[model samples]
Target: MFKLCRLKYYLRNKERLIILQPLTSSLDEAFQRYSSSAADKDFLHRSILPTDHFQASLPRLPIPELEDTLKKYLECQRQILTDDEYDQTVDIVNKFKVTEGLDLQKRLIAKDKRNKHTSYIAKPWFDMYLKSRLPIVLNNNPFMYFRDDPRPEYQNQLLRSTNMIVSSLKFMKTLRANILEPDIYHLNPAKSDNMRFRKIMRMIPTPFVFYGAYMFKTLPLDMSQHKNMFNSTRIPRPGKDELVVNKEGRHLLVMRNGNFYVFDVLDASGNILEPGVIMASLHQIMQDQSPPNTEPVAVFTAEDRDVWASYREKLISLGNEETLKLIDSSIFALCFEDNKPTDPNAITRMFLHGEAGRIWFDKSLSLIMSAGGNTCVNFEHSWGDGVAVLRYFNEVFEDSTKKSVVHPSTSVQTDAASVQRLEFKLDQEMKENLQQSVKKFNSTIQSLDVHHLEYYKYTKSYVKKSGMSPDSLMQLAIQLAYYRQCKQTVATYESCSTAAFKHGRTETIRSATAETKRACTLFVDNHPAVSVEELKKAMMACSKKHGSLTRNAAMGKGFDRHLFGLKILAEEEDGRLPEMFTDSNYQKINHIILSTSTVSSPAILIGGFAPVTPNGYGVGYSTEDSRIGFNVTSYPPSTNAPNFIECVTKALDDMYEVLEGRHPAKSI
Candidate 1:
């Protein structure tokens, strides 16, 4: 026993030392092995390492020295050859070169190529650097870093800054490995062209992250500026304090996808026209400059609706040049019933109008003051996501209220690009063959009874017999559907279910910051995908494999591996090999099929909410041509829970009958 212990100790120590030695290597040796190889060196010298190569790249430290220092620091920390350190060093070096370095170069040229390629490395270092550096730069050099002088317009400045930030974030995320956050920020410039400073600021990080309370003092459109505050656009060296403050109300609409829609009431143009002046000016422009006899007619009351209708009817009747031109370039009226103002000082009336096409309406509290009723208006602007609609509304409202006549910074007109059209010609023979196949399938489908609901029910009951929860049962149903349709098996599948525990049902993790309360706990289960009979035999096996850890284990495994395993299992014969099953691979799949009961409630709610009453809800399934694809969402009424089993069974029968070239009715 003493001899054995000594031998074990010697082996363990030798393994430890071997791991430690490579991490303590010299910076010069590490760089030589990891950096440019002879082939890469030639490419670098010829076209990549020139001084002008990185003119547009972010300001990075000088190359060889920066690379050398990073390598030494990583070595001192005993993290040499680590993916994170190596990537950071690579990024610094690559930025100095014109062309990005090749991935295989790092593998073939590095001394510890195996370690470098073994794992993801760049994220951690980049995350740390961004968090540390961004705040400092913003605080110290906000003007120089963000400002654009040649483009005196704030909108131009905003556009330039957004592009810069996006480019920087993309580089950081790609070159680093340990990063999680994927968001960036942008500033919104106000509409006023003459106003020296744009009032509103905007920030967007993700496709869904929208937060606006982080920047600025007053709301964007504060229309209260002093005359002398406007500055020349040509000033090369404007002081940070020299920035103008336009008091006209400003509004900023921030979208999830880092775009800003800003509207300010200040006049950037020399002539600042207030609301009344702007309206009169537009009317004049319409009459004097607009095409002949295309004046807008007001439709203020129900009485006027008849007159407007008659005018339209007359235009159609005339069919002459003048009437045709008028019809072609018509301006419809936007009228409202006169009412007492909610607030005397309110400049913009908030209205909600449901236009035939898309349009904008501002719903700011200020609008409530001007219009006594809820501000609703109909205008022509296409409705999009909530973020986009909000942005458009704010822009239109601010533009209408602006005291200046400024030309739009960006052109609203879109340019059409060349389109390539492809056409394929098939002979009469091919057409006849396709038509025959379709006719045969149609006849087969018309015949099959194909009601597979009873089978589906039997499967569900069989799954329940194994003692799974309702959620787990739903997950199993989805898995079965996939298996039936795709004939594929997966090693393990995990479903994340939210479970609300009653007292004594389950233990809870305590919160360090707040008093612990009953909360939804995440449950994950990974069960082997086997036949109904096999599952029954493994009943006791379920208990050992089931628990909270299953959730973490599945997440750690990742989506790609889970999909890959499914692909592999689908290729297996009968998808069952007894010895091949392992506890680790026995995961419940990340899929769910809404049972009939589950669909009924939501379907009822949706039906109730519809403007027009719905006739009924029907559930059905359709298979895809792909080897792995999900069935359609099933509903109720025509094919609700009670009849879902019947519907799916029928669909499957129809599918098989058609595939096998038999009459579906005969199969039934």
Candidate 2:
């Protein structure tokens, strides 16, 4: 959600194509890397109850000290600023520390004290997302692709959709019944992840349950956002939007050719219908003879939030109150795409920001499938961070594939009485509004381009053997890639989850640092004096600093959230911006050039999002056992996605050569 909250993009008229910059990557290599750990998930959930039983005992997110935060903030700013600029920023920070900063810090602490059940950053973070009026299309929503089913028959579009729906509903049932395993990171799986440990945990009360796991070196993440994954929608209001959850609703929403269809996935007793019944209903919908909608109502969700909110009120006033409610409260949405895309890159674009009218972006989870069985989940951002979403994503893929909920052939009933088609009462004015929405959405999507580049020369297995942190190494590669493209250091953002604490969101792992600047200059600026040994030394320093930053962010001791809290408190309580907060360097530090995130998992094939700035690049990368991949995005003419990807591959090659003790260049 913080990815594009305060962003504004400038567009160009160039035609766009989703390009896959092919390197030495293959499906076999992908399989060898991801197939290592499916058993790890099942091992951790031997026996458990109440997925959220540990919530009451989870630790609260801590507030970093004011001076500590200012110091760390300057460390990040120093790399991006000149000496003169750095001195000015330091002076401004000092003044704030003695003045508005102290009061704001006190007020924030008191507020956190008053709200012990949640984190200090929770409310301000929510407010930041809610107050920003950017349309959630490219600005906020992000997509994660699932690896195609291994069996050819299961990849059939109808079969894939039916199986995924059944798997997702099963997941919801497990979660609602408190049987789903809690999200936990175990340091020693052998000791903390077995049935013995789980049995001990179940013996404790809810308030003290986490301590049982903590004793065995286990940590449970806050699961507050998981509930929003079902029966929820983000309602656009005039000033601020609302995230509403209605657990009472029990139906599946289907969007095809811009028409809305609903069917009861649950019985009167609230138990899920059998998989055969779901397959029959989906098959019936696919055979429907209705023509494509001339004016799709889903396009209204793509409009600017205030405009959409205004029209939403107009929609309700037109005697469609019950209709809108039913749509919002459905379990989740499943979208059927009309196009069959052969190029994997095109599939990424289709899933990321597909045809606007065919997408209902307000729904928390929308499972989209093409006619050829390419599928992904396009998720709304405000309700949760990736930790919550990824848990659902990974489990759904595993359950559907491993359990085989439905076979290739299932008997269909002519009348699945629960299926209902949703009809909107649209006037001529609303119909005209739909045409304008299409124009606006088209203009917005045209400016962005996406590319995926995979580097198979080496991956995490080699990095681990070389005694380097894989995440830290990849972050440096990204920094090096940007410097090679731009010839300078700039602000960078790496996502780190703080979900170990109560109601935690995310903390910025400020990736750009002084050591990274020295390393990039040595490698990319072609400095002749830098030896291979010296370059390796510099790389180690960069990785070490990055690892420290990641740890600090995960521990909730990072400066980003602490500084954000102070800024928020100042605005909320004093109603004025501090001089320090108004500094130009402060603004520059938050511009977030090279916004990169590492998305490595067994279930996800690729993940991506739009850049946070008009010219900046959004980089989603994965470092696996034997390969690395980058899904690069940018608004072209201002920036180039294809060229940026080329630089990334070059950076990875150079870094790997350095790791191999090769003299890559005379300069380095």
Among all candidates shown, the one with the greatest TM-score: 2
What would the TM-score be for candidate 1 when compared with the true structure? 0.19
lDDT of 1 by residue, 1-668 (tens): 44335434543465664564454334335544644564321111121112211112211111122234223222322211335644554454344222212322232234223333221211221122222211111111100001112323423212222222222222222212212111111234343221111111111111111112112211121111111111101100111111112222221111111111222212343122232332332222222332211111111101122332333344345443332222122111122222433331121111221111111111111111111222322221111111222222333333222312222343312121111111112245433433443344334223212121213222333333445432232323333333333333222222221111000011111010000000000011223333334333232233223332234222222222222222233234235422112211212111212211121110011100000011121112212111111122222232233243433354334323332334333221
Instruction: Please provide TM-scores, in order, for all candidate models, with all chains considered together.
Output: 0.19, 0.91
Error of 1 at 340 (Å): 34
Which one is best on lDDT? 2
Sliding window of 10 residues with minimal summed lDDT for model 2: 8-17
Model 1: runs farther than 4 Å from truth? Answer: 1-466, 490-549, 554-668
Q: Write one digit per residue (lDDT tens) for candidate 2, span 19-136.
A: 2112112433453454355532222122234688789989889998899999999988989998999999999999999988998888999999999989989988987877778888
Error of 1 at 243 (Å): 28
User: Candidate 2: which pairs clash?
Assistant: none
